[model samples]
Every structure is written in C-alpha cells, then in structure tokens.
Target chain A: MSTPADTMKSGPRGRSRGTRTVIAVLYAVAVPVVLIVAWLIWAGVSPQIFFPSPIAIAEAFVNTWLGPSLTNDVIPSLARLGVAIVLAITIGIAAGTVIGLTPWLRELLEPVLEFFRAIPPPVLIPVFTLLMGITTSMKLAVIVAGAFWPVLLNTIDGVRSTDSVMTETAQSFRLTRAERLRYLVLPSAAPRIMTGVRQTLSIALIMMVISEMFNTSSGLGYRIVYFQRNYLIAEMWSGIVLLGLVGVFLAAVFTFVERRVLRWYHGIKETERA
Target chain B: MTTVATAPERRRRRLSGSTAALGILGLFTIGALLEVLPRIGVLNRRFFPPSSEILTTLIEQLGEGAFWTAVSDTLRGWAIGLTIAMVLGIAVGVIIGSVPFLRDVTSSTIEFLRPIPSVALIPLVVLLYGTKLQSALILIVYAAFWQVLVQVLYGVADVDPVVRDTARSYRFSRWTQLRQVVWPTALPYVMTGFRLAAAVALILQVTAELVIGVPGLGRNLGVAQSSGAVSLTYALVVAVGIIGIAINLFARALERRILNWHPSVRRDVAR
Candidate 1:
C-alpha cells in the first residue's frame, strides 16, 4: 500500500515529498485522537467506580492538584527531587574524579562501588527510614543514595578515559592544575557525565515516589496511595496522571539541558558519522 | 624464546593479582570499620549493627523456608513478567516496524506513553488487583514492555533496504525472508532489549512488592524494618543486593551466549 510505484502513479515525485510529510503528520495526530475518542466512548458506556471517565479524571485532577495539594504534596516532592539531584551530582562527580584520577584508589574501590551500585535501589528506602526516620532528610538521603551510584560510576569511567596526550600537553604548557581540570578533563568527560546525569534524574524520580510511599508523608506518591485506600478512585486516577505529567515534564527539561550541554559532542559525532 | 613470550603475560598476571589483593583488602578494611564504628559508639549501634552481626543474621535467614519462598516469589514474578513483555514487545514491534504507515501513526503515541514511568500505574493496579502478585506483575510488565519494544523497533528499522528489496525481487516467501533476514538482524537488538528489560522487570517487581505489600522479598524487607529487627533488616538488604548482582550477571552471560555471533559481543569476548 505504501510502495513507490503506487505513489508515482498517484502524483509527481517532487510534490509527493510535501504530500507525504502532510500525510505522516495527519496519521500521527489522528491515531491518538481516535484512541482517546474510543476511550471516552467506552468510559461513558461502562461508567464503573474503578474505571472513571476521562472527564471525571480531568475534574478530579483539577480539584485535587490545582489547589492546596500543590503546596503540600507536589512542591515537597519536587523539592526533595531537586535537592537530591543536586547532592547526588555534586558528590558523585567530586568523588568519582578523585578516585578515577588515582589508579590505586580506583582499583581498591571498584568492587565496593559495584556492590553499592548493584543494590536494588528501593531496598535503601527501608534502611534509610529506620536510620533517619520518615522525615524530609530521610527522603533526601534515600534518593541520593540510590541516584548517586550511576553518576559516580559513570564519572569514574569517563574521567579514566580522558586522553593522556591532552593531559601531557597541558602539563607541557605549564597550565595550572585547576585550568587543566577545567579545560582538559571535565569537557572531555562531559558526555559520559551527562549520560550518568540522565540516568540519575530518572532514578531520583523513582526514589522520590518510593520514599514517599512509606510512613507519614505528603507527596504525589502518598496522595495517590491515600486516595486508593480511601476509595477515592477518581482522585487516585488523577494523582497517577499528575505523576505521569511530572515524569514527562522532567524528561522534557532534561532533553533541553542535554542539547545545550552536549552540543559539541553531537557535532563531533555527526562529523564522525559523515 | 619461552621467557620472551611469557614476560608480558607474567607481568599482566602479577598486576591483576595485585589488583585483586587490593580489592579484598579494601573489603576487609570496610568490614572492620563497620564492625568497630558501632562498638566504639562512633555510630549508633541500634541503627548500624556490626557487620558480623548482620552476617550472622543473614546466615540465620538462609535457614528460613519463608525467606526462600519470598525470594522465589520475586524471581517468579520477574520471570513471568519479562517473558510476557518480551513476547508482546517483539510481536508488536515487528508488526509496527514492517509497516511504514503504522510506524508513523504510532511513533508519537509511543513517545508520549514511554516517558510515563510504569511505577505511576501502581495505584491503578492496586485498585484493580489489591496486594496480589498480579498487582506487581502489572507494574513489572508495563515497565519492561517498553524497553523491549523500543529496542526491537530500532532493530527492525535497521534492516538494510537493499537486502529487503533483493529478497522481494527473488520472491522469497514472507516467512522465509523473516526467518533468514529479519530475525538475524533483530536478534542482537532483542538480546540488548532482554538485558535491559530484565533489569527493569526486577526493579519494578521489587518496587511493587515493597510498595503494595505483595508476597516477595521486598515485602519481607518492609516487614523486617517496621518490626524493628535491625540486624535482620540489614541481612535482608544484603540478600536483595546479592540477588540484584546475580540477576545482572545472569543477564550478561545469557546475552553473551545468545549474541556470540554479533560483532559487539565477539569483540567483548575477544577483549
């Protein structure tokens, strides 16, 4: 149905490219719209408590999230995520750089670092809760503990891979230690560090939700669980939707930052591909 | 001649041996510190029990039938969920990738759905299935399916257009073309997807159990923590950590076996 012969018979080659773009966009938009309509129809017909209509979800979403829940639940969760992300990145890079630069230390610490990395991240929540209690600091500790490893391990690997020639050149040029670090090391390791940071962001989110799932907390996770336990089905659905939005929002923001930071890396990759 | 050939090899062996020794020494140092810190009141003994106590507690857990059952439950959920996700992912990915119109139609939808983390569905699943294995299964499968699907799609799209056209011109039967061409090209990607999905499936499995109170090691961990069994909690955490490492090693080994012919795997093996 999509053969070149069929398209040639239908129209001229140059015009076909423009029409094809239009068709592709049309198909992309139409599919999701049709699915939503189908969902709306089914949701209307059945109308069960568990399966709330999209309209009901939308209304519940506004009532639950667009009010005090913003301050109490959403803000606290985002705040923890923001703080943990900063702590994880800073600690991971600082530690990773030092260890990576020292051959003996890297060898000594590799297994221990791996063991920490291999720990199923959520398991830390229980241990942290016991040690720190279910407070904000406890939540931050949980998120950072889980999120730190990827960045740390990745940074170590990245730093170790920094070109020896560049370091030698900097030394021969009598560059200051800080200048060598700033110019020769971090930029070279930036791409791998960004990869780790990307992973850390997602892990941080997962840990945030998980840490909130435990005792005494106002968070997106807790709110959703609270709604479920209380049989507020629509509100629960709304809370899940809000969580999804947060994930999407975070990913979008990351993509923007990654593009800016990795522009040089992308340029190099493009040239290499060419 | 023998001395010359073996000189570099001997040095390499010695270097590796020294590294291994250093690694073990590091482990011992940490262990000693952990054991001493609590005893000397540098760290709270209640919160950070000595390493020896935790190890003893772990040995104690190894004897318990319920512990094994919980471990098995987690493994079972992970296996079943990963299998379902792989099957559905490969089947759907192949179909979508083979059709240009379908791929274009679904690309945006897939992107939109992919970023919505599967853990977000925990509430809905809990509402539907309560704290059962089925609730956890929903989360595991949801997270894992996308991992496999995205990889399979990339693999299928990577099939060479010239090779496909040549096969079409030869009138190779669809089944034969798929078997000889598509499957071979897609197998490496499938292996990569399987590895990723394996990790995701385990994470989601543990998360669901821990959060939803399902019957798994994760739930056991929660039970231990809440009951104030401090040493037992550390023991369970260590057990789960070991399990995670084991799963990772198993996935890598399986990937190597399945993708032995793949250039990446071959290069890795050669190295």
Candidate 2:
C-alpha cells in the first residue's frame, strides 16, 4: 500500500505547498463562518423560541465553560468517561488475552461474546439503571459495558493473527506460555488493540452522555436537556457545541496516543498525513 | 457405499441434535432464571420486573396503535435518511477517491468532520429546523453519510489497476467504465458500508427521538421512563433491541446473497 506522502508526491502537483496551506486554513474556517452567518441572518429575519443566534450561543458557551455553575457538569461527564475507559481497557485486554491464547476457550466463548455485542448497549441502559440505580456507578457501568466488546474483540483478532512461525520459534526455544505471550503476542496485537480502543473511545463518550441524559441530575447531557426544557436555547446550543468539541478532542487524543504507541504501523502514519 | 453414507448421515444428525439441545437448554435456563429470581427476592422486582411481565407488556404495546405509529415513524425517518445518505455519499466518495487531487485536498476536512458525533448536532439541528422530521432526517443523514463515504472512498481507491486498464483499452465510455469496472469491484465494500450505516441509522433514529421529542420508539421509551412505568420502559427497550437485531440480520442475509460470489462467503460455506 502506498503511503499518503507517496500519493501526494505522485499526484498532479499544480498547487504549491503554500497555496495548499492557505486552502487548508480557509477550509477550516469556512464551516463555522458559514454557520455563524446563517445563524445571524436567520435570527435577524425571524425570532423563534428555540433558534438562538451565534453571538448568543458564544456568550452562553463562555458562561457555561468558564462560570462555576455549569463547570461541574462537564467534570461529571468527563469523569465518567475517564473511569469507564480505564476499566474497559484493563478488563477487556485481560479477558481478551486469556480467550485469544486458548483455542478451546475462544471457540466456546465466541458465540456468547458475539451475541452480547450484537445487543446494542444503549438499549440496555434501562436495565443497567434498574440494577445499579441512576448514580455515577450506573453511568460508568453503561459506558464500560458499551466500550468493552470492541476492544476485547479486536484484541482477540489481533492475537489470533500472530504469525505461526513466531509462536513455533518461541515454543522451540522452550519459552513458557507467559513469556511467549508477553514477548510475542502482545506486541503483535498492540496496534489492532489500539485501533479497537480508538473505536471504543467515541462510543464510550456517547454512552456517557446518554446515560447522564437518561437519569442523572447533572452532566453536560443533563444540562443540555435541562436548558432546552426551560427554553434556554442559547445555553442548549452551547452545551451541544461543547459536546462536539469534547468528542473531537477525545478522538484526537486517541489517535495521537495510538500513533506514538504503534509507530511501526504504517497505516497510522498514513492516517496522520491524511 | 450404502453403509458408508448411512453412517455419516447418522453422525451428522447426532451432532445437529446435540447442538440444538444445548441451545434450547441455554435459552430456557436464562428464561427461568429471569422469571424466578425476582419472585424469590434475589432480584429487585420493582425496577427489574420479571421476564414474564416484560413479555406481557410487550404484547400489550404491540396491540396498541401508538406502538405501530412509533415503529413506522422511526422506520420512515431511518429509511429515507439512510437512502439519501447512501446515494450521495457513494457518489461523492467515488469521485474523490478516483481523483487523487480532490481526495488529498478534502482528506483533512473529512477527518475533522467525521469525529463530530451526529447526536451532538441535535441542538444545532433543532435550532435550525425545530423538532421536525427534517431535523431528525438531517441528524440521521449526518450519522449515516460519513461511514458510507469513508468505506466507499477506500473501496474505489483500492480497485484493481489491471481492471481499469482493461476497461479503458476496450474503449468503454466513462459511465460504462464506472458501471462495469469500478462499481462491481467496489460492491463488497459498498455493502459493508450499507451494513454499518444501517446500525448507525437506527441509533440516530432513537437518539433523535430521545433528544428532540420526535414521535418514535425512543420518544415512547423516554415517556415510559419518565412516567415511572419501569416495566413498560424495559419492555420497550427490549423491543427496540429486537428491532435492531432484526434489521442487522436482514442486512447480513442480503449481503450474503449479493456477495455469494465473493471469496469470503465461499470460504464460510466451504468451512
């Protein structure tokens, strides 16, 4: 597979690097500019109950993020995500390693894992809330449940894909199971496992928000719904924007970590360029 | 020859029987536990509600017109939004993927936009279009489009150069070349994209309803939960899960039928 750098070099190169840089900056600015202009025009022409102008939303965003009143909401949502992701990665990797290492265990458990994964995690929120109650535990439980399967599945796949020659060489050297796993399997699987973690991070964030929206008294999700209920349109929009930014930030962080950890993976390097 | 065939048939029958028996036993065990635990006070009956109660409520909800209305509304939005998304996404993706310059130019923009969760856009959508079908459709479109576009782009870009060269040498028109050479080569990836989009559409459908107060299964779930009808809420949640599973199964079956010629399905069949 050709890398993005190679493609860029080979492709028709009419535009200079400086021109491309300018285009990239303009493209980045265009979306928000268009949105703001549209919002201003719409708010000017017709005032409605739920439609807030860009200026109003900006003011509201400052208040929500900077002010003490709503900062706790962001903290709760972030805290839930942080705790859930930590638990998910730790437990998922351990279980996945065990299952992936043993052929018999994998064969026996694959069906059950697939079934549970197929059942959408959000649909289980009600049951989770019932079992755990609408506390931080419930929120964390839902996020963990939702995020676990992807990482686990990917890790198993990665381990299973380890080169047979490497395993045989380790076996010929009389390497113990633990040593073989530690030296050979985990490194081979790390990139794929990281990919799974990247996928799960977004899902984890989504579930964190949804769980809060379902039952919690505070959080970004709750604040958005709360403000909407009270017809605080600007505040609601601000909350929505912050949630989007949070999603972007989390995804960026995951990608950055993945690149650093799996520097050998060519696809990651290509993706960075893209 | 007769004896050999008979013995193999008998062994196969025995294996299938054991598999079926095991599956049934597992299902029954779960069902019984879910039923008996709450009654025995090991599980909380108030919030958890017995499996039998959930079944009864499911039946009751199914009989009501409101349930059907919600289903239809959800399906309508999901189908319309997904179809539009697929059509436009595949078109744009193929064009960009085929043209190296455009793909390079837009790659950054696509990456930036793709990570923004479609659900997070509900407030902006509601602000622009209010709690209308348009807003719901927009959200679904946003969710479904990116998944398909990314897959389609990769698929188109990955098409075999040999096939393209052959098509060009045969003096095929641009449209003919695309139809004969590009699309068929990319069909498997396109199907995978559609499958991913289907799951995304359902999620967005329910989410849109939950957040925007649109009339769908999610709205019904929200109402039931808020009203303290814990049993009904649980039942509805299960119903939605079943719907999602059914949609997935249907898509998988369609994919198998369409891609029967592909090596992946052939390998599975051989196994």
Candidate 3:
C-alpha cells in the first residue's frame, strides 16, 4: 500500500535519469520520423494504393482541421461532450448525494444503478436513435446515458467515505440537512467526485463518437466513417490522427485539473507526513 | 434491554439481505412496467417494443444459426485480440514499471496514447488491413492493451519492499525473485486490468463489426435495426448486455478464487 511518493524515495535508480532522457527524445521524434521513412520507402516502391504517405495525411489534416470544409465537426463533438459532462456531473452528484445520505435510498437505488451500469452504452445507441431520431440530440442523449453511472456511483462512494464524526458534529451544531450537505459532505467528497468526473469524461467521449458513427451526419466520428466509406485513406488517417490528438489534449487537461483541484489529496504530501 | 438489543440486531441482519433483494426486484418491476405500458398503449409501442415481443425475439434469435455464427465470429476476434493484448501489455508494463528511467520517459507517451478511443482507429485499421477480421482484432487489441498495461504498471509498482528485501536476503535468483515475489504481488492488479480489458474487448468487437461490417453480432444488430426488425434489434442488444454481464461476473469469480488471500476478497468471504 505504499504511496507513489514512497516508491520514488526507495526504488532503484539505475541510470534512470539518462534512460528517461533517451525515452523522452525517442517519443518526441520517433513517430514522425518512422512515419516519414515508411512513406518514403513505400513511395519509392509501389505507392499506388499501398501507401498514402505522411505528407498526404498532413495536407488532409490541414484541409479537415484548418480549412473550412468540415472543421466544424470537432466543435459539434466537443459541444456534445460538454453537454453530456455538465448533465452527468449535475444529475449524478445530486442523485448520489441523496442516496448516500440515506441508507434506505441507497438500498433502493443501488441495484438499479448496477444493472444500468452493466449494460454497455453502444447497445443502447439504436434504441436512442429510435427514440430521438438520428440527430445531435440523440448523440448527446447517448453520451449522457453512458457517462451518468460512473459519476453517480463514484459520488455515492465519496459521500459514504465522509467522516461519521464530522456528520455527527454537524448534527450536534444544529446545521440544517442542506447546510450539512453543502458544507461538509460535498467538500469531503470532492476528490473522489473528481475521479468520477474523469471516468465520465472518457465514457462520454466514447459514446459521443459511437453515436455519431452509428447515426449522425456531421461530427468527427461521422467524418471518419464517411471518409472510410469513400475509400479516402489519407483523409481517414488524418481524422484518426486528429482524434488521437484530441484525446491526448483532453486527457492532459483532465490530469492538470485533477491535480490542481485535488491538491490536498496529493500523494507527495501524504508521503512527506509519513 | 438485552432482548431489545438482540431484536434490533436480528432485524438489521434480515434488512440487509432483504434490501438487496428488494432493490433488484424494484429494478425488474420498472422494466416490466415499461414493457407493459407500451403494449397497453399507455406508452408508444412504435418507439419501444413490448416486453413479451422482445423476449420472444430474443429466444428465437438464440435458436437461429446466424446468431450463433455472429457470436462465434465476434468471440474469435475478441479472444485473439485479448490474448495478444494481455501478454504484450503485461510484459511491457512490467519492464517499464520495474525500470525507473523507462517508466518516467514512457509516462508521457503512454498518457498521450491512452485517451485515443480504440474505435477511432477503425478507419486507419480498415485502410491498412482491409474490412476483415484483422481490422476488428486490431481495434480490440488497441482497446484492451492500454487498460491492461496501466493496471500492470500499477501492479508492479505496488510490490512491497519488505517482500523484495526478504527475497534479496535469501539470495534468490532474479527469475525466482520475480516469479515468487513480484508476480504474486502484482497478480491482483493484473487481474483487475484483465477484467477491465474484457469489457473493452467486447465493446470494441461489436463496434468494429458495426462500423466495418465485419460479420459479427454488431453487424447483425445494425442490419436488424436498419431493416426495421425493431424487436430483433432490441433482443440482440439485450443479448449483448447479457454477454457483458456474464464476462464481468466470470472475471469477478475468477478474481475471488485467485486472490483468496487478498484482503478485499477475504473480507467479502468473511461477511
């Protein structure tokens, strides 16, 4: 159960600094270098349909992302993600708090939540399509349904983990139920709640893409599907790379926000105290 | 006073078990109601099929040869991809986690690559491998690999120093040390990663078929839905849900059996 900080303290060093430096450099340069070399080698040999080349992909990326043809795809996808996440956080936290605060409510709700959580969101995409039709609303609804469970379950766990003593103190001090929830429970649950938010973000992204792929006409997912159907290999690869870049950016932002928001829960502080 | 205390305790025990049962019952009741309401015209039947029809369709599909064919094809891709992912993921994760410099250097890259949804790679895969089983397997591998790798890294990194020191004191060979000490300590995390990977593998399997038309349950579901066999589509969706649940339950059972000594499982058993 040693914290990551403790591992840093006592683990073997073994030229780790030099190794890290080499790894960093390789990661930064290796992908583009390898891709370019592969393109060149393929171009020299056959190049008809076997390879699309790195430069082709780059040009495709610029046209798709920078130029005005279908760049708005990214925005709609982002907007769906934004709506889903906001709904997930707000509803998830509210419902989780009520259930966590009351044992009877938890007992009544836990099984239903578990059943829904077990069902994959992709399975529900067609059903949503039927209900809402193949529109942006359907896509957003799918994202919301997919993202809701993780955040809700995590929030419940976070609230349950709140100190009983603190709860009792609030009671003794005659704090109203709402006041106690706002002042004590929410603050204590914030770290775990954030973790839930992180999980929801990933799920939301997946559903957003899946819904678009299955039913929609305009998002990044549709673009990927559309390009594939037309046999535009370069355009398709460009979309994939763009999506990967988007994933990386979102994950980085999540990690940064998580660290800043959950500063008090940092492993370094825990290890230092220990 | 003693009788009163004992009565409350007994009631509490009864309540715990009954509450769980009640929760499950409540969920099913709601589902049943939803099914019935649509049939009765209280809810729209066109949008939502009746529960009886969904069940009948599910049973009929299960009996069909095409359904089994779809199941086997999907399972083939899932099994091959998951096997490869597990082996490579664990090996790479262990190497990276055990070697500090490697871990630090690869951390950023891993994080960068981790968020790319495996389904997003479907287009590139189709282009490279063509619209076939390989495309589906590639997507499954991509989906499952990162999950297993991250968990394996955490597992290796979590190995207790006291155990490592004890092994060292015994002058155990490196292989022996790793086999006896590191592997056991990391087994729980690796298993957890496998469980998570299983879910991802199933999802990716279906997604690949749906997007690429790769002859699986997903393709069947898509076909059924598009052809306006609404009941059949719902039935297939339910079948997929059951498969997912079965995989999860099997993983949990396996974990409990394998990690009987682990504190979490031990506590559950004691309860």
Off by over 4 Å in 2: A1-59, A101-112, A160-169, A267-274, B1-26, B59-66, B127-132
Which portion of correct inter-chain contacts appears in model 1? 0.65
Candidate 3: residue A273 lDDT (0-100): 52
Candidate 3, residues A1-274: lDDT per residue as tens digits? 5645445544445657777566557755665566568777887677766357778889988877776645478886887788888998898999988888787777767666766776766777877776787876777778888788877987887787689999899999999988988889998888778877877877788778878888667888888889988988888889888888877777888889888876876775578856
Q: Which CAPRI level is candidate 2? A: acceptable
* Total backbone clashes of candidate 2, pairs 3 or more residues apart or in separate chains: 0
List model 2 lDDT by residue over A1-274, tens digit each: 4545345645437877887677667655665577679889999899766767788989999987778755588876787789899999988899999888876566556545655676556666666765677777878888999889878987887787789999899999999989988889998889778867976887787787777777578888778878876778888888888887887888788888877777776675578756
In the order shown, the candidates' DockQ scores are 0.45, 0.23, 0.37
lDDT of 2 at B104: 64
lDDT of 3 by residue, B1-271 (tens): 1111122232234346778687877777777987889978997888688878899999988899989999888878888989999998999998888776567657766777889877788777777777689998888888799999998998887787788888889999988988998898888888878877887888888878876788888888888888888889888888877777777677767766888797755655466
Report lDDT per candidate.
0.84, 0.78, 0.79
